[model samples]
Target: YVTPVKHEGVELNILPPGEDLEQIVEELWNTGRPGPEFRELLEKSGAYNFYDFIIIDSAPFFDVRYTVLSIYAATRYVVVLRPSIVDSRRTARMLRRLMKYAKDFGLSTPDYMARFLGVINLAKSGTIEADALLNLKFTGVKPSKGFNPFKHPSDERRKNLEKSIEGLRKVINFSNYVLPLNADISRLEFKEIIKGGKSDNDLKNTTENLLKDIWLHATCQK
Candidate 1:
């Protein structure tokens, strides 16, 4: 008896840690690989047809090639961030940059915000960082004007405060999916995956809310 094949998840045609990515960069330079061509590669691979969503984990902001290419290729974005002040500040800056790029590409203001789903609520329970960020979510009406963290160079204390305020402002705008930081999905057992036995209510709810956001923002009719 033959077992039926299932669409488990993604197929990662991963490049080894070498100059393969660099070679692609050179090839693209020669043959005019536009940034959106990354998305084209995805569609051509047949994976984009198979999966409802495709998450591209690119290198950090240091890698300009993968970073810009991924952003250009992505239809929408979800920001999963580390629970720290630095990440928060970067989030604010990054969102602004993405918006600028979209507008440059002819997206109107009303439709521009639609490109982002929401940020993951990665606040760890009882942690001070989580508490501080959560305060921004609950208390602030919006980010204070001129909340740029890197503005004040002379005063270290003021700079730190600016960073916190900026981070707070960004989270207030994007906090929708509540993923409890305690639920360590990385170490989940294989049986748990197959049977879906262990249930974390937070994770489940987060998954649902995320799907709801996708539905609300999606142009494709399913």
Candidate 2:
């Protein structure tokens, strides 16, 4: 029984830890291999019928059985990261491991491998630190305006903000991804923003443009 936070356009099904389900997953991982029952349970979760897309936010580490299970069930993956060299490198390594698992299960063909999505968050424009993201080879997105967690930096501190954004932009550019600069909303305003009105339209437009290329890549297989 997956307790997903059900929504119209998105369903957030979290893989919880330290629960009864966790124990079962851990036992499966101890075997060092996936079996028929594992695939059956994952398929019977009914995600495909319930949602147009299912985004699995797995654990950061790969040792956990739940994380591997989530990756096995995924048709597409979206990797969200801040623009940093460490984050980029870590994600790259993670993808490598996930692909290795997929290949073991006969799921690592070109079509299956093409479903990975990358995204850079809290990105700033015109910075060298941001360039580190360019080293990665994948399609991704960045916020149009950088997220300033400092909450209205004083004039004296404004320079620091500029520097932060500059660094992230480098990562965004390096990844060759699109920038959804004005599309970000605060956590508090997210529900209301997407409920309707100009914010909703803006979000739709931004998402459409950002995903157009990805859609083509996903469906245009010859």
Candidate 3:
């Protein structure tokens, strides 16, 4: 059930969590069958035609049924990844599961994969970001094919990380999506904007440029 809620004068439809909804979910799971309840609600209301877009954010695990339903409904999917080893490892697991699920549903890998956009968040300087950049470079190149940055005899997650990075690179190129958000100049400019200083123009230009690319990638009809 999506209820309309207003935030800062903007209207947004939100699904409020409650026990009643939980009971329905549990019953749906126990029955092990797809039901018409949600479809009926969506189709009958005709609200789907009213909105320009609907975005679904899922858990790290992808959570099976709900994740499948969301992906089935999505026209485009954007993945937000933190620049770090642990986050890369987690992303590898999540993306592999998502791709497998998509394949099982008879979706073409190229078509399905094309709709994906990747964004690297909170990218900072030093060894951590450098290591992350290296991972991104060999993203789709398999460990068996060539030298892998993550390769280590003791690191059990090396293969998975390699594959995950590859999957991400296949979708989002580093030049487009990797924002230098944590750099000293960027931080100073943003701070000035936040403080209502002279960097207002800087902030506006920066955000507009960033959002232009992001919006184009996310909403552009392929």
Candidate 4:
């Protein structure tokens, strides 16, 4: 039902508008035979065991429905977000609420946070504050939700957390994965991003390390 289109060296599987596959997916979702979400179609696509990963980069026009579908389809997700202290805190709180809502409505399973790999900050290069937020280690914290360590270390427990983080600042450079804002990459399509990033040796090395971390994150999950 789907064909893989080759763009440059990357192969893309697209579901364009008015396609029969799209119509079939819609029919299956409505009839509730296989499932009510797009994720079921993805599982039965015969592509899972063939590829190490399949990224569904789609605009969430249906917001909650699409978000839940993507979350369900993918084993894990990596968030690309800007590094801001307040926004870090807000992101954690918002995700907890989303998980609860998704669970209550049967849209998704619980423990949604477990599938989160990590965040890649889009902050400007040489930004100390952003680096600190990105570099903070995620271990030992009781409630280490996504970006939780980046939130203000206001309380006594959080202060201990900050102390632990400060000790690791020099040792573990997790912020090495941060992809600073670049005009070339901004708003670029998937194929373009892949093509443009191939020439940069520094980017290639860092991306390789990031992929290793992502695989470890997936394998280490319970």
Best by lDDT: 3
RMSD of each: 8.4, 8.4, 7.4, 9.0
lDDT string for model 2 (1-222, tens) is 446676768657764454586678767767766544566665797756876655556765645555567666765555566655566566656655665565655654544555655555655443433332322322233322453344543433344434443444343222245343344544424445445464656454444544554554434421
Clashing pairs in 1: none
Q: In candidate 3, where is summed lDDT lowest over 10 consecutive residues?
A: 138-147
- Clashing residue pairs in candidate 4 are none
TM-score of each: 0.59, 0.56, 0.62, 0.53
**For candidate 3, lDDT tens digit of each residue in 133-172?**
5555512111233434655423435445545566567654
lDDT of each: 0.53, 0.51, 0.55, 0.49
Q: List runs of model 2 lying over 4 Å from the truth.
A: 1-18, 35-37, 44-53, 62-64, 105-109, 130-184, 187-208, 211-222
Q: Point out the higher-scoring one by lDDT: 2 or 3.
A: 3
lDDT, model 2: 0.51
Maximum-TM-score candidate:
3
lDDT of 1 by residue, 1-222 (tens): 213343457343433445577777556556565565666776787867766665566664566566666666676655666556677567666666556566544787546555654454455555444444444442211223334333433435444643665544443335444455544455664335324547554455555555565566544331
Model 1 C-alpha lDDT versus the unseen true structure: 0.53
lDDT of 4 at 162: 39
